[model samples]
Target: MQVKKADGSDYEPNTISAFQRSIQRYLEEKSNLSILKDKEFDSSRTAIAAKRKSLVQSGKGNKPHATKFLTYEDEEALFSSGQFRDHNPEVLQRTLWWYMSLHIGFHARDERHKLC
Candidate 1:
């Protein structure tokens, strides 16, 4: 199907195949569940599945960020600064810590939660 471009500038070619595949996988995984036997259970399960599929199909899923990923140059520049070294004598230790932290992804969403 054709839909508006993600950038919102003009029409573009798009398809619902990704969403459909996610739902199909969910149904296959839960094929043993009887929808007719339990109304409450089935409804709740379906709701959760749909929510998960929606999150995956959208860019809001629980995966790594595409843009703004750190590069080797950025990491080196951050750790090699003299100001940062002056505060901490354990230069190597802190450098390794920052490297691992960046590799694993950050817990803070912004500067407000940074020190926390």
Candidate 2:
């Protein structure tokens, strides 16, 4: 059996499971994106660490903005900056599947209740 969505597209009979799988896939994709973000952040941190170490070892540690390099605080600050906030592609897909699952489940229960 097939179910028709509001857009006139036929959703397969097992749409609940399909929606669940879609949600899981979206979560996995989000997790992968987060890992990529972390790797980028780590690379930047490593670069900053190298620069700081070079400057300090050369007897220039007392210069202005030297504290920024002292404890690698600059990396922490940059990581928290909103530089990669636009990378969430699966957010809308996940939301749509979630809403569709809720709607489908609610309607199914309502129909069962009406027949009882």
Candidate 3:
């Protein structure tokens, strides 16, 4: 599968690993920024803590679970009816945005704890 970066760059190889590395780098930068901005430290730390608690409560933090993917039949139906592409575009977009946001947030929290 091909992965597209936010900057419109395309990368081939292991997309999961690439995304992980990108999140790591982002977290590192965020951590450095947090360290320099002592005034915002508490707020940032609290936000991270809340997210950590949420993930734990949801049974998704550091636990092995089945990764959900769109099935071939689902994809075919979506493409054929154009439901996901048109009628529910907002839902699809929002879902993707949330997924990326949560992934990045959790990854950043992990990196912050590691650094600490």
Candidate 4:
């Protein structure tokens, strides 16, 4: 089995063997082969998840669970406040289109698709 880095990078095969050896040595010393059979793996998975969640919340993770929804009036006030009032029509239209896409859940990755 492969072990992931704390930052969630992929494991090299050599690193996996080293990790397995360390865990095996520790378990042998503890007389806890049962961890290999079950509980510790589950615990480790939970720990990884918790760490990832913490990183995401702390803004150290690049992925975006970072934004919250805006209230309707707040959103309206923001877009209607004349920020783009002097911009060309095409620019305002594109900006509004992007705002609508994001509001409807088209995120960073999804914005690349043809708007069909």
Name the candidate that leads on lDDT. Answer: 4
Give me the candidate number with maximum TM-score.
1
lDDT accuracy of residue 108 in candidate 4: 67
How many residue pairs clash (N, CA or C atoms closer than 3 angstroms) in each of the candidate models, in the order given? 0, 0, 0, 0
> TM-score for all predictions?
0.34, 0.22, 0.26, 0.33
Which candidate, 2 or 4, has the higher TM-score? 4
User: Of the candidates numbered 3 and 4, which has the greater lDDT value?
Assistant: 4
Where model 3 places Cα greater than 4 Å from the true spot, the runs are 1-32, 35-37, 65-116
Which stretches of candidate 2 lie above 4 Å from their native place? 1-37, 63-116
What is the C-alpha lDDT profile of model 1 across 13-116, one tens digit per residue?
A: 12233444566567669885433345646664565556556646664444353457667787567757642344666765665556566666666657325633
Native-referenced Cα lDDT, model 1? 0.52
Model 2: per-residue Cα lDDT over 2-83, one tens digit each = 3347997543323433554565578677775432235655664454456545545655445453222224564345335632
lDDT (0 to 1) per candidate: 0.52, 0.48, 0.53, 0.60
Judge candidate 1 at residue 10 and give its lDDT.
Answer: 25
By lDDT, the better pick of 1 and 4 is 4
Q: Residue-wise lDDT of candidate 3 within 14-91, one digit each (tens)?
A: 344445456657878776543223575566445545554654565544434434566789657765765444457685
